[model samples]
Target: MGRQLATALLRASSLEPRHINISTRRPETLGGLFLDQRWVSAVLYSLLNMCTAQKLGAGKTLRLLNGLFETNTFTYHSLVNSPSASDLNSPDDLFPWMSLVDAQTKDTPLTDLVLRDKGLRDCFSVMYYNVFSNLAEG
Candidate 1:
């Protein structure tokens, strides 16, 4: 059930395997998808960034799952847009984010990260970045 969902999401996002992050509380349950353990930390950071970028409202959450229970990808974003409040008040929360691609790490080769990693490379075609507009009613 998990693998099937992950595969479906990979196809949908067109992220290519390298850009996806598969993680779980139980690594054994994820099976072979795990690449570097440090990826989990990266994922958390990405999620936190996205969440902090947007304006808080109903909030938005997206999840990408795969078949064979091999990979599981998740993302979420939430923010508060208020001119009266300063950006300093924003709360940074990542919960446990992970990504198929670690764009920030300098040492790791992207090709190796993509071609070598099983689930991360084989999942999607491209990674997406979302932008939010911060505008106050005139």
Candidate 2:
């Protein structure tokens, strides 16, 4: 269930690697949760460790993301404007989002689900910046 939501959010947001953060009760517990590609980040959340709060800050998780992305920090325009910029409004922009949404709706669990390395589940799960794959690059 955790991984499903994580992957769904990833696909919905265009596979931005930086946006996803996985933290387990211990660093060693971060296993499973790899759905996108090599460029994606797989963090390990931990109960003893509260690093997420540091980055997200005080009780503003959803609000922070809303404002962050709303400012166009990583919007389609932002990507297209970057040095490696491409068209965010193109067909490519919508494909991954649609595909990801479909996978989630169809109940396709993330590939290679495992819990090796002691990464505890239920500690934490997050969706952060996306790193576009070659498929997204026309």
The lDDT of each candidate is: 0.33, 0.28
My TM-score estimates for the predictions, one after another, are 0.25, 0.19
lDDT of 1 by residue, 1-138 (tens): 433333434443446665544332343354533334234333433433444344322222223112222344322221112332243332242222223355345322333334445555434311211000001110
lDDT by residue for model 2 (18-75), tens: 6544342442365534434211212211110122324432124323322423421223
**Each candidate: RMSD:** 15.3, 16.6
What's the count of clashing pairs in each model shown? 36, 20
How far residue 45's Cα lies from its native spot in candidate 2, in Å, is 23
- Global local distance difference test of model 1: 0.33
